[model samples]
Target: MVLANIQQGEKESLRSYTNRFFAAAAEMEDVNPTVAIPNYRRGLISGDLSKSLQLVKPKSFPELMARASQFMLLEDTGNGAPDV
Candidate 1:
């Protein structure tokens, strides 16, 4: 799937990559969370968000998004690396 190939740019911020990822996801029909979640995790650049997702897998797309949103906020506030 094309989405599977989506990757965060070298210098892209988490929020920017998340937005781009969703935009690509929205274009597809009946996206399987099983496939989408893995793709999302694989695409993330090495960081707190990526590490969190790897250690504690999200059961659903919403859960993944929630975690991503939290990490993105932390990144925006200059706390990209969470205590996790």
Candidate 2:
């Protein structure tokens, strides 16, 4: 299957970018986590969650997602804004 390139828009939020990434990734018949994880990280704009994930080194996609979810929650709470 042909997968479209994933990109993070300048004004896009992390949640939006992640949703787009997953949508594109789902189009691939054989999504390899090993490749997907790095690609996901590469597409993200440099930020706290990305840095934290790099340091933690998640072993699987689920772990990486969990970290992202936690970060999103923290970000939302810290900013006092509802997740978009």
Candidate 3:
């Protein structure tokens, strides 16, 4: 929660956020990487891509997108999503 608030408030401060994230990770009410990871996964399944991406900011955008893609429907070359 502390780190989240810091990140939420200081959107321009990555170094501070990284420090606070680790510092607060152990004490967060429910902000452990494990919990955040699954929320991110569910967000993808639910088509809430923004929330999913916010949960895990990978070093690169492509890697982050690829992580989200694991939970996305594998679209056909024709851009059709097959029946679930």
Candidate 4:
């Protein structure tokens, strides 16, 4: 199976970009969670979402997902995004 190169699109929301990254990561045959977690973080657009995830310092893929979920929820509630 060929894996698509994942990237954050211009004007794409954090949640959408993360979802795409997660989907691509899931398709890989034998990805190490420890390594993949940092790659996932690197793939995020540079902003609050990315910084916040870095702060959490997730050690595994699942931990990253949990943190991303919380960040998305906070974004939904209008509390996570930085003011322009």
lDDT of each: 0.88, 0.73, 0.41, 0.72
Instruction: Write model 3 residue lDDT over 21-63, tens digit each, in one string.
Output: 4455556665556445333333232333445456555554346
TM-score of each: 0.91, 0.79, 0.29, 0.76
Estimate the Cα RMSD of every predicted model relative to the unseen true structure. 1.5, 4.5, 10.8, 3.9
Lowest lDDT sum, 10 consecutive residues, model 4, at: 1-10
Ranking by TM-score: 1, 2, 4, 3
User: Where does model 4 exceed 4 Å of error?
Assistant: 1-5, 81-84
lDDT winner between 2 and 4, please give it: 2
Off by over 4 Å in 3: 2-11, 28-31, 37-84
- With a 3 Å backbone cut-off (N, CA, C), the pairs that clash in candidate 4 are none
Best by TM-score: 1
Better-scoring candidate (TM-score), 2 or 4: 2
Candidate 2 TM-score over all chains jointly: 0.79
How well is each residue in 5-71 modelled by candidate 1, as lDDT tens digits?
9899999989999998988999999999898999999998887888898999998988998899899
Query: Can you write out model 2's per-residue Cα lDDT over 11-64, one digit (the tens) per residue?
Result: 887788877888888777878888888888878888787677677677787887
Error of 3 at 22 (Å): 1.3
The best candidate in terms of lDDT? 1
Q: How much lDDT does candidate 4 score?
A: 0.72
